[model samples]
Target: MPGRTGARHAVVRPPAAGRTAAPVAAGLVLVLLVLVVVRLPWVGDLGMHAATVQRLRHSPLDPGNPLVDADTPSPYYSPWMLLLGTVARVTDLPVFAVLRLAAAAGLALLVTGVWRYVKTLSAHRAAPALALLSLLLLWGTTPFLWSGFPGLHSLALTVSYPSTFTLGLAFHFWAWLTRAVRGAAGWGVWLGLGALWAVILLCHQFSGVVATAGAVATVLAARPRRTAWLRPVAGLSAGAVVLWAWPYYDFFALFGAGDGLEPVHRVLYGHPVARFGLVLLGVAALVPRWRRDRRDPLVVFFALGVLVVGAGWLSGHYSWGRALPAAVVPAQLAVALEAVGAGRRRLRAGWAALLTGALLLGGWAQAGTLGYVVPRGALPQALEDRYRPPWTGYHWITPWVRYGDVVLAEGRPARQIPAYGPYTVAPGYPDFFLPDEERRTKATGTYFAERTPESVRRGIEREYGVRWVVDRTGALDGTGLRAVARGPDGQVLYAVP
Candidate 1:
């Protein structure tokens, strides 16, 4: 807040032509994203999210383990998903259709939130539009695809995820918190902010971390009077109450269950140069801002993100890598701000040129995302080579598998089968809260073992109420199971006799 006016005091407005072109470019990028969402390609965790919606639609109050047939609490039962579930139940729309609606809403919130937050930093008309583009396309040439990171390719794949919605709300939260701290906001406003903070956390825990870091950075940069401290404390207390009262899952308990996630998240630390080299441009922008004001919000925010992520790597809690956005966003915003705010015209032009080059390279690197909206064959050879095909899904098994029926499957099939309303014997993803996760996983392996006795396989099926078995063809031929159907990639659905 100290630098609210100081940071933009020497600002120089962009040219009229630039003012017109920035928004046009931003709008076109958004339209491309809309097409990607409309297509809803099956990639990453699509099956998991689809299954989560499927379960919630049938039993909103007690939608158990999303991937397995167990009465366990799931962190995925966020307020947003619950709302989507309600909409699905009322309209009887397919789960994927509801997800598309969710994607559109999340995208709108994200774009508007970015606009509002950028306005708080600078008054320039083109700043917001430039910030939007930088946030999406200023990453390194490498295609880093993840749920929380908003690199063009990643956002295209995870447009419908709860992480996207949560992150969008995070931007709004930071903007509002910055204003509240700078002004004389009443206790009621602070309390509402606190509750909103908790809701964001419940919606997506990883993004919640990013939001909390930004909130902390905002308050620190504001340098509020000692007497004003009570307001933030009060807000935090209110948020704690909401987290405790939420009945769907034990949000606090997740703190102790991160060990199981280290293996998967370790990858986030890999390929640092290819994934984040472009951020150095923003780092350069931040040096001047930091010199002008030690407590500059973007500088402080980037430091906090780096500290958290570095600690995660050193401490082996790689799940903390999700907070990478905290660092990346500030840097991205710095580049956008410097492009228009530099006092010297030459400096501004140089920054603008650098930014434009980075955007072009980033965009081309992520061009493969077009495969989601257009046919791969129609794409140029270079683009096609970069394109990764999406999952074909397990719709072929849906005719033989009924809703709520358990299926004994492993690997990719296990991941996708539940999207159609059936549960797998073991979860394809990590399940920290599920009490019987290890047992269920072991049972799935035992059932599919080539040397396991037929009697043992039957017992395992009876134990879990598995009505169908999906595996490679001929894997269960001699087990007295009847073949139900054959699916893509040589997978066969067999009935458990």
Candidate 2:
């Protein structure tokens, strides 16, 4: 009888060793991420963000196009960047240093926010840790690095982006909303949540969409009481008010401006199988969740995300691909919840093994992210092979290129020079708000054409206040501009005569 009773108990409860291991593994992953944040290696869009901070620091109220000298308002001027800009101005810290600080704070918020939100889903002690690990590692073996996605490699690269900070806030917002809608809460809490929703939208519009989808799923799954229904309405009203009252840029105009963004975002739809194949496991996990409760929050959230992303692909509104997280995250969390909350002993063990295998595969695929913290040469041969070199910036031109000086350069230098407080003849990234963007682009191209008349080149120089020129070696050797410095990759910086 004692032996039979012990077997039943073991089947009912998870092993103590497994429970202890989950948290330890989670802690170690977070520590590794912190080291990456400390290194703060340059990658995609870092230049644009750094330049945005530089502009905001110098002129907060009127900071214009981040990569050019236009006076037009920019969408990048969010509440988070404003705060970081203030820090830069007051402390006189380099923009990248301030970015490192931002990265650390964002990482902390993300960690705590995940913990709080997962707690609302399950009382199981291991659920939060498992959820964190699942969120970071349940993607396909192919490494998909992007701003809004929080896969380990992507998060490491975009730790400093507004998307990270805003996504962190979104998790907290969802947690608070879940609790507020379920329990009796005052009108003030609802109104505050509404304002927070607006702030999240303002901070990173794409993440805001993801947050909104999750919010709807939360409310739907909760099936709040009739009295609680009015609270969401009041909260939404407050959010609309905040969005309207924001003075930096017209928030509503963004809805109609997706046309210009579609081209670049089209790439997000490529390689559907390679980028997200492993997530199907989570989808398989969702079947049991749906069977148990048809209106499961995770299922509802995944449905909504699929609705948006699928529509984006079909309708040519690919920019909506940013909402991929809405679908991806709920599925990831469902797997974690199942691993911890499964009822049958064999079923639970099966889920545990599957999740463990997926995580190991995903971690190895992103092992190259370790190169961000350790030297590339020091990485194991396999990791080094996977590692990508970060952008080598145009800091060499800083000695000659003063603040706000317009440089006529067309490729990578055009993208990177603005980070050091100089503007470029053409903005490296797309600029929907800049009225003369087309004209400036033409002027830059005309200046660089080999057969252009010297007089026409000089005219181009005076038109945009082009103080410097950066291009390939000997590209403009006879243009009469004084050669200021030569940088890596055959880039030459010339002072306009």
What TM-score goes with each of the models? 0.97, 0.96
The total of clashing pairs for model 2 equals 0
Give me candidate 1's TM-score against the actual structure: 0.97
lDDT of 2 by residue, 373-441 (tens): 889889989999978788888789888788999988886777788889999988888887888888988
Give the residue spans of candidate 1 off by over 4 A. 1-11
lDDT of each: 0.89, 0.87
Give the alpha carbon lDDT tens digit for every residue of 1-497 in model 1: 11354234444556789897879999998999999998988878888888999988999999989999889999998888899889999999999999999999989889988998888888778999999999899888889999989888899989899999998999999888878987889999999999999999999999999999999999999998899999999999999999999889999999998899999999999998899889889989999989989999999999999999999999999999999999999999999998988477888889999999998988888889889889999999999998989879787777667899988899888888889999998999999988888999999888888889998998998899989999874678767888878888788888988
Shift in Å, residue 278, candidate 1: 0.9
TM-score of 2: 0.96
Report, for all candidates in order, the number of backbone clashes: 0, 0
